[model samples]
Each structure stands twice: as structure tokens, then as C-alpha cells.
Target: MTKSGHDILKDRLRRAMGIDLQTVGHNSLRNAVARRMRVLGIKETRQYYELTERRAAELDELIDEVAVNETWFFRDDTPFTVLQRYSRNWLKRGRGSCLRILSVPCASGEEPYSIAIALLEAGVNGPLFKIDAIDISYRALRLARRGIYGRNSFRGRNNFFQRKYFQKTKAGYVIAKHIKHSVNFIRANILAANLPILNSRYDIIFCRNLLIYLDKDNQKVVVSILDKLLVDEGLIFTGHAEPGAFADSVFIPAPYPKAFALTRRSAVVCKPDRVSYNRQILPPSLPVQPLWFTELDTARELADTGQHEEAMECCEQYIRRHGPDKEAYFLMGMILTDMDEPRLAIRMLKKVVYLDPNLVKAIEMLALLYKGLGDDNNYRVFKQRAGRVAARNQPAGKGSE
Candidate 1:
């Protein structure tokens, strides 16, 4: 494709999905375009560009090729913890007859399914909550509607939910019928003028990781749409890199460690440091933590909120005060990975794995870091190790229906 044609197609993608070509990478856009052209048997770039202009369906096809749908169940784990607590409160207080939640760009089905599982575990019955899962990729939506997931979708150390809510099948793990029924999946771009959910208001919105791919102007536009869709005191859960997108908007960070939640400025009834909602929901029997533990918690929260420098300082201090701690090293590895220092992150993750050989998350991180650095030997070694550890730690019984 010529440079001019590529530029025109990039602009069209920006207008259609609020995507920043630079963030998605120029090479990725070029590759997606080339793949679509090949699939359509078109030889000329100009003809393909003209076809995109003439047919909306062709543009949609291009979008399916370009969209990034990498996600897993309980990706971060903290946001769902926050949601469980918040839903328990909503149910206790009788805030409404039904709690409404929205998950946009809910890649595949893991996120919405995870949300349902969290609520169910929190004792919120199926009839008391409604979830709307939306995505723009037709291919991803089809997979989501199938409600079947491979091992890649179930990451992390916990497979308790998998054992409880999914049936092991030859194809994959088939999601429970009730959990699949709980989420209503729809295919529509969130940036469209006629957004499907404009007429509705939600109590909770999970818009994680979508804003980072957009330009500054589109970021602001998305924040406005989120504000319009949220109720007066509703919460917005965003990705760790996305809190800055709402910094100048009507949203303020909610007081919960690692939750990455925000609420309207007008809803700030309590001080920022105090977690009144958490206190209300936390059981009285819960134990208190040591001062050093709270400091590490603060470091995790800082990292989640994009204060990488401060977070690194906190980690350094923790290491200085306490001798080489595996948890601190693991946290440092994660922060370094986010800062694009794969080598440094690899060192930290290696220290973590050395201290606790069976720590599957750290092992997985080492595999990914090695893969990123193009060290296929080390990557394969750690990848195989992680798989072995995961298999040994699997829940007692095979998954049941």
C-alpha cells in the first residue's frame, strides 16, 4: 500500500473506532489491512481502500482484523473483589430492585462471565442483577456467544471458579448455562453516534483498557460517554493505564486499593483516604495487617494508578527495610514490565521464582518477559515450568457440570 492510502485508511479507522494508529502501531495497521486484502483476493491497495469506503461491512471486517482482543478471566483480580463487596452493599441496602452493570469491549466472554461468577459468589442471585456485555468485533462476539473457553482464558493461580461454574469438555470448558444466560452480549462500537446503551443508565461500568488505544480527543469523548451512561453515584472501573483518561473529567478515584475505580466528583461524601464503603461490607472477623503490609498495599495501589516512579520508590523502601522479599520482587517485576524495562523486570521475576519455585504467576511473567526479548529457549523453559506448576496445583476434582 502507498503511504497516502495507508494514511487515509488510518484516518478512517480513527473516525470509525476512535483508534490511534500510533498506539496500535503503524505496522499492526498495515498488517491488518494486508490480511483483509488477501482474504478478499484484492491485489491493489487502492481498490481495497475504495472498497472500504463503499461498503460498511468491509470496514467492519477491517476492524475485526485490527482490534486487540487479548483478555482473560479475572485479569487483575482486584476490580472483581471490589465489585463483590460493592454488590453485597447494594443488595443489603436495597439500593434498587435490580443492579445494572455494563461491560464494554468485554473481549470474548471471560469478563462478563467472571462478573456473573463474582456476583454469584457474593450471594447476589441471578435475578437480582443484569449484565450487558458489548464489543465491536463480530468474530469475538461469536466466540463469546458460544460460551466456551480454552485454557488460555483461565489464567492466574485460582481455578476454583472454573471447577465450580464450568464443565470440562473435549472442545474446552463450557460455561454454565445460567452464567451464560446472565450476560446479554451485543455487537456495537462504543464510539458510534447511536450507542446502543445511550437510553440506559448503569450502576457499574467496566470500561477497562479501551481508552489507552485512543487519542487524547477520543479519550475525552469516551469519558463523556461514560459520564452520560453512569448514574449519579455509580462507579466506573477502568484499566490501570486508563485513570488518567478521566483526570480532567467529572470522575474522582474511589478509595480502594488496586480497584482502579472512579466515581463522580459530586458523589464524594467522604474523605479520599477513608474507605467507608469497604468498612461497611468487610466482615468483623477479618484480621488487621502489619504496617509493612499496608506500605506494600500502597505500592500496589500507586502502581495501579500509574504512579510508577513513586511505586518503585515504595518498593525500594520496602526492600531496604525488610530483606529480599519475594512479594516485593514480584511487584517490582510487574511495575518494571509496565515501564517497558523487560530486562530489569526479568531479573526481578527471576528472583521471585528462585525464592518460591511454585509461584505460577511469577513463572508465567518470566516466560512472557523472555518471549518479549526473543529468548525462545528461556521462554520455553519457563512456559513448561509454569504449566507443570499449574497442573500440580489444580483443584482436587476435574470440572463438573
Candidate 2:
């Protein structure tokens, strides 16, 4: 008996591509086969499936079409936040060293470009830093190399980066020369048993928001491969929503404050002079985080409209993105305090202090909020801490306001 068209498609797609049409759902599979058949000039689905089975290269091309490719520049904030922090510190530590990064499933190349831009922003330059980007689609790779997109791509673009990083042309907006030069985009399938293009280790691997589409087992396999590619003492950045995907290893969350990035825990984690990661039970008094003002302005507007709920939610969203700034928590605390939610205000202000120990205004407001809630002990403690920190960080003639 001759097999049906659907049967052939299921078998060829599964065998040739490791893509189980059964897992892809029958309806979606049917649509994809139909699309490919029309493009391939196969009069019938059976003929198309037969072609794919007989032709390995055609099968590879078809697989690229079926794979997911949806992405945008700076799609999530946390990973970029992690990138920014690591670049500053790493450049300080490993000056003149080659810092390499990989962007898996780098759909259409915008992501890799963004990472390159981030590296530039963090002051990595002069041939010391490099980026290795990959994607499954030759089609997407072509577009990425062009480095030109509609000016609308810049609309509502919360980053002022492009104003400095792009040049206007009849060909559209070309990426700045520096960003374009730092990155290398290769086209390859990440799901394959082996990756030929990426044989070397990298300082960072940004495989964000891509694994959620895969089956559980495939997700694990891909993650394991990515983990292997990451350098010891390197960093990994992913989506906040997909944290459960990587609930393993010494992959503790790095404090991006507002964004999400994870640092690889080496066998021996080093200690910086001012900050000690080990033997440190001290309260977090680090600065709130470097603020990316372009994104911050939107969150600020959300607060001005009395959309406290949305304002706070936006604040939380921004925090998960890696661009944590001290002002975010302070804004949130002010909203709660105004609403007479003193308890929440005190808690939020505590976060501000951890982020910026010398955030005197936060301490003052927090003390008042605590006193309103009958928490005199906290009010006194915060007040004293604020006084001492102000005196310490303050200029000799300057006093705490």
C-alpha cells in the first residue's frame, strides 16, 4: 500500500530533521508542508516529501524554514544588563584579552548586533573583544549582514544607542562601523548533534527565549550543549520567564537588579577589593545599578499618571530585564508610601539601600514610612545608617541633606 502524503511528511521531517511532526501538531505540520510544497514546485505533498527524503540539502533548507526565527533588538533587558556589567568589570580585569560571545538561534542577526552594541557601550574595543553569532536560516543570515532595516525599527526604540551607532543611507540604516566589525555571524543548526562552526569556548552565551519551543528532552540537550560552550567564570543570560529552563549547575542568578544574567561559579570564585562574594553576609549596599535612561523614562512616565499598579509592574518588568537602577525602587517606594502602604514602602526602600547604600533620600523617606507604620526600630536604624553613609561618601564640606 502506498503511504499517504501526511505519513510521508511525518516520517521525512522527523527522520531528516529530528523534527517530529507528531510533536508539532498535525494541523501546523499540514500547513508547513503545504507551504513548502508550493515553494518547491511539487504538485503533490507526497512528491515533496519524497524529494526531501531523496535530497539532503533540500531537507536542510526546508528544516530552516520550519524552525523558529522570531526576534527583535534588545528583546529582553536582563541579559543585556548582565552584558553591560560584565564588560565593564571584565575589561578592567582582562584588559587586552579577547572576550568572545555567542548568540545561538540569533534570528535575523539583530540580536548579535545588539550584543556587539552592548560590548561597545561597555567600553570593549580596539580588537580585544569579539562576537560569534549563529542562526539556522541562511535567509535570515543574509538580512543580518545587510545591517539595514526600516527606520520604523527604531520607533519606540527605548535606546538612544542607534543615534550614535547608525548612519542614515538610501539603503536604510546601516550599523555603525564599530558595532558591525566586532561581530561575526555564521549560519548553522544548533539542534544538530554537533556544531561545526563553534568549536571554541566563549566568555558569554546568550541563548535567551529560544528553548521554550522545544520539547522537554530537547531543551535539556540544547542547554547542556550551551553550558559546555560557556567559559568557566563566564556569564549566561536568559529570559526571566524561562529561569526554570536552567535550574541546574552553579548557575546562581547574578544580581542584575532590574535585569536577568547568571554568572558561572568557578571552582574558586575570586573576590574583588571592595566587594566580597564569599564570607559576605553583609546587607546589599551596592549601587542600585547603572541606569539606561532611555528605558527608564518610559517607566517614569508610567508613574506620573497615577498608574501605581502599572507603574510598579513596569518597574518589576524593567528589573527582570537587567537594567536595574537605584531610582526604580525609590520610585516604587514613593508610590506605595503615598498610597499609605507603609509596610511595602519600607520593604522597597530597604531594597534601595541595598542597591545604593548612600541613597540618603531613600533612607529619609523610608524612615518616615516606617514611623507611619509604627516601626520605630527600623526608622531609627535606617536613619542612623543613612547618616553614617552620607558622612562617609559625602565631600568634606558637603553634609547630608
Candidate 3:
């Protein structure tokens, strides 16, 4: 192996998972590498690197373990909300036809399960719709098949899922057979030169939070392939770090007030409970950070896409140096919101308006926080600011786009 042991490991990772350790933050990358080693019972990075470069039959297992497949049920809340709102119209139009849904990078089935939950809740059932859940990780696929979960994995979902969809099983909770049967699970790599599914055929594709980890070249390749995988009128969803990749596509953005989605002309737009924000839309990332511009964009994106913890570290670093930019406060508020710390989000947003009085989104978000807290007086003020922003952002009498 002409490459250094570390370099060889990076190459194998790039080949299998599209992860470049040189670019991924060293701490996160090292920990992730260590995590894979733990899974494989390797004692150190050197051995792991050696194994990674060997191309032995063990490559598959190692690749699966290293892929940082972090996921959960109802992960983002908005995309599914958008889907839930749109499903009614979709069902109404199709009348009796089956709706085909696909979730690529479906990691352990949470996204597919989320789709199932949304579709079932929308009252569109039976043969009328289907979800094809696919992933590259055989290990992840195996776990998806198991359908068991820990209390912490989805701590509060027991009651809702119990009431809405699942039943007690020999292995914790299995999604009701009806729900399980609604999906066809396949262990497949989306980046394979050819995808098994027909081109341009799915109605909705939930590939959220998956593409950001890939290199830009890979990102473009995947987007082009997904454009083909998506029906002319199908919708494609990506993560907060990834909204930029879709800007030039044939897909038209149907950014609902609260959620994220892009639709073909025939696709329906849904009105969510509240149109919130998502993603940083910056280009590229680096391995380390002193809060570089790309890193700010990444943090802004992390905060934007609702991955607040990852985002907070970036914003907090910026704040430590620059002393409380309103945008930093706004980003901080977003992280707090994702953390389910609405009171904290309120405090953070308050700081945002204190720093920049004209920060409309901060005001609107503050209103939402107050509404959550049942402070109607505060709600009205922030709501008015939101309305003003909305009015100004809106075109006059449709004279312009």
C-alpha cells in the first residue's frame, strides 16, 4: 500500500462511506474511528487503519460501523409535518391509487418509520401507499429489521407510538404489522453506479441529513442521480448543511412556512403548524475550526437545520471572540429550540432583539416561545414583528417573484 496507513484508511473510508477524515473535524473523526474500532474489537487506529486498507471480506462490517449513522424517530419534525399536510391532497388526487414513497439513506429505518407514522396519521392507508426504505449499511439494515429500541433512543415516543402505531412484542415494540408491511426494506448503496429503482418515479423522497457528509463531487453525483430517481413532480429533502446542492436543479423549492421541501409542479404544498427555519446552505467544510467562515456557515447551517448542539459549539466559539452578534444569538436560540429548551430559546432570542432591534425572525421566534409559555402580551408584539417581516418579504400584488 503505497499510501500511509492513515492515508490508506482515509481512502478506504472515502470509497466506502464517502467520509474524508482529513476534512471531518479531527475530534469527531477520531472518536468516530475509535467507535468503529470498538465495534470491531480493534485496539488502536493503526490496526484499524491496517484493516481498513486490507480489502478483506471484513471491509463491509468495518465500513458499516464507521459511517456515523446518527438518526432518530421524528428527527426534524418539519419535513414530516410538511408530508403529513401534503398527504391529504395527494390521497385526494390519486383517489384510489397507491402512493409510492422512498427513503434513501434510511439508516435503521427511523425516516421510513417517520414516513409511515405521518402517512398513517393522515388516514391514507392500505395498498394506497408504500414506502421503500433503503440503506447501504448492512448492520443498520439488520437493526432496522430488529425494530427494537432503547428508552433513551426515543425517550418520550412510547406513549404516542403506543397509542398511534405499535404494539408490545417479544422484542420491545414492533411497528404494527400493517405499518411494517407498508414498507419494503432493502440493503442498498445509493451511490452505486446504478440504482435498482426506476428513474424519475417516486412521489416523495426523504434523503434528509445524509448528503452533507459526502464530498462535493459525490454530492453532485448523488444529486444528479436523485434528480433521476425523483419523479418529474416528486419532492426531494436534504439536511440543513445541504440545501445549496439543490439550487440549480429542475426541482422548484416549495419552502412551506415551517418546513423544508422541494416539489415538482404537480406536487402539493402543505401548510405546517408554523413555518420555522432550516439550514445554513453554505458550501463545503474543513477538518478543523477556529470558527472559520465555512465553519460559521456550517454552524449557521447546523443551527438552521435544527442540529443545535453541533451548531452551538460553533456559535459559542464565535461569541467568545466577537461578543454576542445578533445572528449568533439567533443561532443560539435555534439550538436551544432543538434542545427542547424553549425557555432558553426565549432568553437567547430576547438577547438577539436586544442586540438588533430589527431582527424580525428573532422577534417572531420569540413570539412563538412566548406562545408556548402562554404569555399573550409578549406573543402579540413578536407576532406583529413577524407579520411585518412577512409583509415586507412578500411581493406587492404578485408584481414580482
Please list the residue runs of candidate 2 whose C-alpha ends up more than 4 Å from where it truly belongs after superposition.
Answer: 1-26, 151-156, 248-250, 265-401
User: Who is ahead in lDDT, 1 or 3?
Assistant: 1
Best by lDDT: 1
C-alpha displacement of 156 in model 2, angstroms? 5.8
Full ranking by TM-score: 1, 2, 3
lDDT of 3 by residue, 36-119 (tens): 778788786777777755755566766675666778777767677667656766765554667788898888877788788778
Candidate 3, which ten residues in sequence have the lowest lDDT sum?
Answer: 282-291
TM-score of each: 0.69, 0.67, 0.61
Question: What is candidate 2's lDDT per residue for 229-289, written digit by digit as tens?
Answer: 8777766777656556667755655433345566654421222123221121233434444
TM-score, cand. 1: 0.69
Candidate 3 segments exceeding 4 Å error? 1-3, 22-24, 27-56, 155-159, 168-171, 198-200, 264-401
Model 1 agreement with the true structure over 160-224: per-residue lDDT tens digits: 79989999999999999999999999999899999988999998999998899999999999999
> Distance (Å) between predicted and true CA of 25, model 1?
1.7
Against the true structure, whose TM-score is highest? Answer: 1
